[model samples]
Target: MSRRILVIDDEPGIRQALGQLLEYEGFEVKTASGGAEGISLYDSYRPQLVFLDVKMAGLDGLEVLKRLRQADPTATVVMISGHATIQTAVEATQLGAYDILEKPLDTDRVLVLLRNAFENRLLSEENARLRETIESRYEIVGRSFGIRALLERIDKVAATPARVLITGENGTGKELVARAIHRGSPRAKKPFVEVNCAAIPSELIESELFGHMKGSFTGAIADRPGRFEQADGGTLFLDEIGDMSASAQAKVLRVLQDGVVTRIGGSKPVQVDVRVLAATNKNLEDEIAAGRFREDLYYRLNVVPITVPALRERREDIPLLIVHFLQQLAARDGLPARGISEDALRRLQELEWQGNVRELRNTVERLVILASHATIGAPDVERLVGRRSAESPGLGGLLDIATFEEFKQAAERAYLLAKLRTFDWNVSETARALDMPRSNLYKKIERYALQRETVE
Candidate 1:
């Protein structure tokens, strides 16, 4: 499809020349004699780019630009005028003009400017889409009292410049809470950088946090800015901060105290204005007692503490979370909408999710992909959770049995379930691997009530 270009100029000669030139270059061009007609055409045509004369007879170029921008904030308008002063150019720019072209315009310069302007617009649109996707991915979904209270705390903490320390069990969405605070803060438009302390090796964590100059370390090919510098005038999230080495902890403490970060191999301290939001699944108090984490750093980061409640603590929200996750997954994967029976949802709510919201979402996605029926039922839930239960350590491991028959039965059950999962419930393949007939394996699976999921 050809790009649409609109030329809004009072001079018929200039308009006709540009229109012909743009049309020859494969752009769909529209011309307007004055600002009033230009604005009307803009509303109707919705062109990708606009070239407007600054000094027009009717509505001035700046006024039209403002009106167009107010109608569509993403409008890309370039101002052109034969009598353009520095002050006039500045005013046009302040009114959101994309560029100011002096009149008797060079065709070469106009084409080059159009190319750059369109490229920038494309990049901006892509970034906006990505930002929306990220926000949706990290959306906090719940309506329970615990969730309400957490949201209230987030609102209060986000308005301040206090350092936040979010504590929660693994998979409880600590990072999501941290992002919510960052999005709510005054620095929402600025960078929101994150570092996972546990993922990086202890030896390289210092360089990762404080950066390093070229040749400072083995892999340092160029001077690099750390998370603090990258998140300048914004929010820096330190996830799994409890896993940070003691040396790194001390450096973090120093930065928190003075708002300055000195690179690993550099003497100069670079000043940074960053709000720190830290999260950890570990008990920092216990870590401090064990001499693992720094006491001063703990005190500094704990200025505004938040604890994300476990999934089981808010069972009422499980259904809502499930619906949210399922909808998001369906939309993202281009899959048909899936539903869960009331009994199935209730069964989910009854279980204790040690892994919390993350686990529930994963489970929902799995069901969406693997369920045979459009509406997931209790039996489906049972089969799915049963497979997971067999994998987890349970009372069978701790219980002592007196008879050989009891022990043999339990071992056989566990063995058969593991084999079935390995084969993904392919009866023939599992039977072959187990050195048994397919019929016998089926009988055993039925006797044990073992369920296998089918993945498409």
Candidate 2:
């Protein structure tokens, strides 16, 4: 399809010339005589680009430009005039004109500008799609009271600048809550920098939070800005903050009090404006009782305490969460799409998800990949999913099988191994549990070379 160009000029000659040029250049062209007609034509024609003359009889081009922008914020209009002053050009741009072209516009410049404009629009549209996808991916998917209460808390605290302390188990989506707060806050457009305190070694954690000058340590080859400085005018998320060293905790306390940070091995205090949000699975009060976490820092960050409910607490939402994970897996990961039987879903909900939502999502992905049929049955769930999925690979590690026979063999071996471990390697109990003859169970175990392990 060709690009659409609308030429709006009171001068008949100018209109005819530009219209002819655009049409010759393979653009679908339309010409309007005045501002009112141009605005009216825009409603029907809906051109992608417009050339509007500045000086006109009743309503001027600037007035039309303003009206067009008000009607459609994405309208791309270029102002054209033979005697446009600097003020007129600046004013046109201020009103969201794509570009201001002098009268007797250069044909080459017009073509290049259109090319760049369309490319930029394509990128903007793509960015909008990615943002929508991300927002949907991280959306809180539940209608249970716990989730509703959590959402209410998020809405109340999101708009404020008060420090928030998010408490939840390892996979209960603490980061998601933090991101939700940042997205709703006034600093949504700014960068969100996160540092996992537990992941970094304690000896270097202070430098990681405050930065370090060159030659400050063995690996310090250059000066680097830390998480606080990087998050200036934005949000700083300290994940697993209870694991922070005592020195780093004191420094964080000082920065929270003074709004300033001094680099390690450098005494210059640099100011920063950052909203601190922290998350941890550990109980800070217990840490304080043990003399590990500072009480002062605990009070500072605990201004607005939010505890994310575990998956077991919201069992009613398991079905919705399963559906969401299935769709997300198919869309985002390009995994094969599959459905779950009602009984299978019930069985999943019956199990204790010690790892919470993260574990559920992983199990869904595993089923999508490993299940034999398009709709997974309760037997498949029972065979593939183990009590402690965090420890055992089970069917999740069966992807390397070459063919159907190999896949069957690998799955059977895993299932038998899990059963044997569950029965503590008792052949009679394992055979009874499997509902198979003792001789067959022994032969299968011997053939597969199953061994007893202390734990999964």
Candidate 3:
């Protein structure tokens, strides 16, 4: 598609000539005789670029430019004037006009100016879009005390190159915190690499961390750089660090101590400058006691510990998070944005978010996509949250009447049932979706005396 350009001038000859010239250059051009008509055309056409004559009959060019900026701050408007004065040009520039062109216009200069303006407009838009994406990606939109405190801590730590250890339960936005730290740090312009320690196999862990030379192992057909080398001069996030093998922990400690890495089957130890950020759900002290994690590595990585508060701990943020997610989902899917009722939001705040912020986001997305009503109400939240009515024989009612042990059993049963329903009663799907081993799910089903007939 051709780029659109709006041409505004009082003189018919100048408008016709410029319009013709722009059209010849493969631009879709529109012309207006005066400032009022130009503003109207600008709003209607939404042109990417505009050329406005300064000395007009009724409304002058500076007023038009100001109004244009009010309508679209990113709009690119070039001012053309036959009686060009320094004062007039400075005023136009101050009013956000893209450029000033003195008239008895040089057609060549006009074309060059137009091209520069167009390219600049494109670059500005692209940069704005990128910033928007980054903001959305790391947005922790909430007003709770816990969230505010967390943001304050982020502001403080982001200025330093400290080795940060983020401790949080699974699905509590630990990685998001890590990314925010990297983006805010001095080395934000450099790479931010991540390695999931729990996902890599024990045998390949060394190669994954420190790289491997060609023919070093069964899979090493070529030399490759690892996470530490990839994250040189930047920050490397090691997730689920407690699950890493003891041997890998020892190697990581060595790298931290020496600030260098030696790849498998490589003769030289390559020096690297990397800031380490590690995260885990397990207690590192307990792991050390069990001889599964290295104490030296733990101390090295724990230079600055940031514990992400669980969702339940910050219940006040639930409503804010819900609103943020709803707006995000609606924008992404091109659907009309909806709101949750105050009562519904309060109910959500009362619930225990075992899966934390991640779980809450998924719940909001599900509701936005699947809810029948435009405004989410308490009943809708209850249904989506898998909460049964107190009158029913499920956990909701059992909690009120049953003893502590009985309530615990009932709650466990209810949670399992909810997972089963979420996965359409496919045992494998339910187990995987719950991040539990299939055999364990089966054992729980048997121990709870869950009837196959009931599940079906």
Candidate 4:
């Protein structure tokens, strides 16, 4: 569709000339003779770009620009004036004018400005669409009472500028909750910046959250806006907040309290209006009691606490989740849609999902990838879960696991050891067999304290 451009001027010749020029350039043109008519047309047409005469008869361009900006802050209005002054241009810019055009409009400059304005609008629209697509990917997908109640709470707080702290076990969709809130909020059109505190190194956490100036640190080559600045006027999701360093936590608390952030090696404190949503899989209260987390920071973040129920707590939604995952995965990967037998689904529900919804999705993906038939059966389910189950009596059996973390560690150790044995301790071959980077494999080996077993 052609972009709409509005020209508001009292002079008939200028209006006619500009209208003809814009129309010839393939823009949908709308011309108004007076300021009142221009404002009315703007209200009706909602043009993407507007060219208004600064010295109109009754209501001037400045007033119209102010009104347009009041209606839509992102409106693109370029002021055209025969007798232009620096003060007038500055005032127009302060009133949110896109640019100022000299009285005798240069055809090349007009075309270039129009092209740039439309390109910017297109980019902004594309960004909004991408954000929507991202939010859709993390849509909450259950109908249980727990999920329904959570959705209700989300609706209640989504429109407001309240801080939310989500708590749940790993893979229980804490980030999903945060994204849902952002998608439903008033600032939905703005950025949604996320930071994983646990994934980033402690030394760089400050820069990652609050940004840094050029030459701030050894590796700082250029000025960088941190997550907080990037998320200005929108939502900032801080995941794994419990893992943040003490210094970073204090800085985060200050930002939350004062709505301002100072970059590393910079003296200026930049103010940002951001809605913060934080998530953690660990119990922050316990961390505070253990002196690892600050109590004051906890209270600041836990304004409206939301605890996502574990998969076991909402088992009724397992079948629905299974079906959703199956269809979604099949569609995404261009695989034939697969079905899970009732017995298979039942077996799945009976097992504990220590990783919650994430574990379930991974299991479904594994089955779809490895299943021989279109319909997955109980035996297939058993074999997949059986390998990771603590009770299975084999190389993968982890019967001694006392906690979920221990269970995961034992499974990793067993799997790594078995793969290493299968490949005759060839690290490259074993890493290839496991489809992991060699460095990651080596790290896992070190983390699990894996050692070669002596032959009898």
Candidate 5:
């Protein structure tokens, strides 16, 4: 499809000429006489780009730009004016106009401006898409007290250049928290380099942290920069830091202390400005006690410690996470958005997500793609959770085995049995369990067709 452009000017000649020029440039163009008509056309056409006259009858270009921005924050608006003034240009810019064009229009300049504007618009949309991908990929969606507190801490820590150590179980979103911190920081525009200490070979760890020159080692085919050099002026996220060898830990400590790195086979140390963020599932203090990790380096990296709560600790957030994952999956698959049935959602909430956010996201994605109906019900959840059970041997699978009706019956039976056992088989215990002032548990005992068995 051709790119759409809308032109709004009081002068008919200017509008016609510009529209023709743009159309010749292979753009689909539309023209409006003034601000009112321009807004109406904008609403109807939803052009990718707009050109507006600065001076108009009812509403000026700046006001039009403001209105357009209000309607669509991402809409690109370019301002045109024959009687250009510094004040008018400034006002247009303040209102978020893409650029100011002075008339009689310079065809070459106009073409250049339009090309640049379109390219920038593409870049802007791409950036938004990338951010969205990152956000969804991170998959930390929730509004519970625990989630809110964690977000608040992330916001506060992101504003500073503090060395942070995030400790959590595997799959608890420590890396996600790290990325969120980097995205919210001043260095967001710069690179965010990640190094997994456990994944890299111990022998190559030094070269990985600090780049190697040509022929630096047996496999040194060419010069390459390390994570520290690449992450200069940004963030270097060292995941599984506890797995790093003692030699690598010492080198990391030096970088943190001196803010400099020396590449292998290179004489001079290169200065680098980088914020360090490290995460690990292991207890670093234990590693230090066991003589596997350096206490000094641990203290340096642990200036600010953040612990991500596991899913089990914040069960209230499970429903919100389910919806977030489904929406994200639907967007990715180009399908109409769908919702989970209340029964399914309730079952999900009861699950102890040992794998935390990562596991929950995977399960939701699976259900969204594989589920046959528009709304996932309890049966679908049972199937998904049941599949997981076959893979792992534990109580994790047991809870998912009970059908909806079976679960309801089991809950009722357990309530009555607990009351009978607690009160030494008193009828009052049954009544209390049934939430009745009198004849409560007895009525439930009769309603559920309860039977008594003597203790051995």
Candidate 6:
């Protein structure tokens, strides 16, 4: 494919020479005599690159550059000047000209500028495409009442620099909400740094969030910027914040207060401009009461609160989600596209999805891979992902769990629920049978949000 170039200069000799040279180099060339003609042709020609002269009769170079940039912010333009001053060059650059060339244009320099400009354009194009893919991947795809409400809150908070605290059960897509907030913010083009507070060890979490100087600790070989520094001028997402060590939480609170972070072994505090977004499956209010999480940090981070609904809470949107996941799988993973029967979708919705949307997506992926037919039916779903059972989530569900803590919690919840049912919801009997304290059992029930079916 040939790239287009436009030469806008009052000098006939310069225009003809550049146009001929560009033509010989396999470029589609267009020549304009003056700035007025150049601006007029810009709309029609739509050339990828433009070379405009500084000295023009009607419209000046800076004005033309500004107008061109206004017409298309992505315009690639270079200024050609016979007698140029530093201020003139600076002004051209500020007006969005790609580069400034002296009157006697060097063939080598012009070609080099074109190469560089086109290369940068390609990079910008690729970045735009990647951003689109990322946005689509992290899209919140539900129209359910719960989802609509959640999205409404997200929209209300997204445009502000206010800190957000996202709360939800495991696999409920809290990260999606955080990403959505970042995407909608003024800092959308900036970095969105994430740190799984629960994943890092207690011994190293402070250093991880605040950076470490060389030889600060046993394994600290070189100076490294932490999550706070890396996310400066962007967003910092602290996932599973309830699991963060208390010491680290205090440091985080200080950072939020002063916007300054000191390295592990460094005294100097580096200032940062970051919008912090924190998420946790655990009830942070409970965590604070239990002294497991810091109250000060919670207040700082919870300027805006967003709770993502569990999948079961919005079962009506299950079909829409199935369709979305199918399309996503096909586009992103190159998986075979398959349809789900109404019965199958309904069956899926009926199940108690303890693992939330994450669990459903996994189940969908399994069906796409293992189901025999082109379209998935209820029988296939039952055989593959089991039936619509509310009380019992099979051993497969435990095996599907990714994190050890989550597995332990799920196992404990299922065990406790079963024991309570066996005792006919007699708390005393279940507590006695499990050889656990009644108060402890009650606390567990509250933690898991477990309840009995009410007889209507």
lDDT (CA) per prediction: 0.86, 0.87, 0.83, 0.86, 0.83, 0.86
Clashes of 4: 0
Cα shift from native, residue 440, model 2 (Å) = 62
Clashes of each: 0, 0, 0, 0, 3, 0
Give the per-residue Cα lDDT of candidate 5 at 449: 36
Off by over 4 Å in 1: 1-6, 12-33, 36-45, 102-116, 213-223, 333-337, 387-456
Location of the lowest summed lDDT over 10 successive residues in candidate 5: 389-398
Writing each residue's lDDT as its tens digit, candidate 4 over 371-416 gives: 8789999999877667344355252224544688656755676678
Off by over 4 Å in 5: 1-16, 19-116, 333-338, 369-374, 387-456
Write one digit per residue (lDDT tens) for candidate 6, span 1-456. 349998999899999999988898889999899887888899899999999999889888788889999999989999999999999999998889889999798999888888898899888888988877878889898887668778777877899999998887898999999999998999888999999998999998998899999998999999999999999999999999999988888899999999999999998989999999999988787689888988888889988777777776677888888888988888889999998899998888787677788888999999999989999899988899885465444463466567887789767976886788789789999999999999999998866645553332
Shift in Å, residue 240, candidate 3: 1.0
Candidate 2: clashing pairs of residues:
none
Best by lDDT: 2
lDDT of 5 by residue, 151-189 (tens): 877888999999899987677889989999999999999
Which 10-residue window in model 3 sums to the lowest lDDT? 447-456
Q: How many residue pairs of model 2 clash at the backbone?
A: 0
Task: Work out the TM-score per prediction.
Answer: 0.75, 0.80, 0.63, 0.61, 0.69, 0.80
Task: Give all candidate RMSDs, comma-separated.
Answer: 15.3, 14.7, 14.1, 15.4, 12.5, 8.7
- Of the two candidates 2 and 3, the one with more favorable lDDT, higher being better, is 2
| Cα deviation of 304, candidate 4, in Å | 0.4
Question: Mind giving the per-residue lDDT tens digits that candidate 2 earns over 20-67?
Answer: 888887889999999999999999999888999999999999999999
Give the per-residue Cα lDDT of candidate 1 at 301.
Answer: 95
List model 1 lDDT by residue over 8-101, tens digit each: 9999999999999898888999999998999999999999999999989979999999999999999999999999999998998888899999
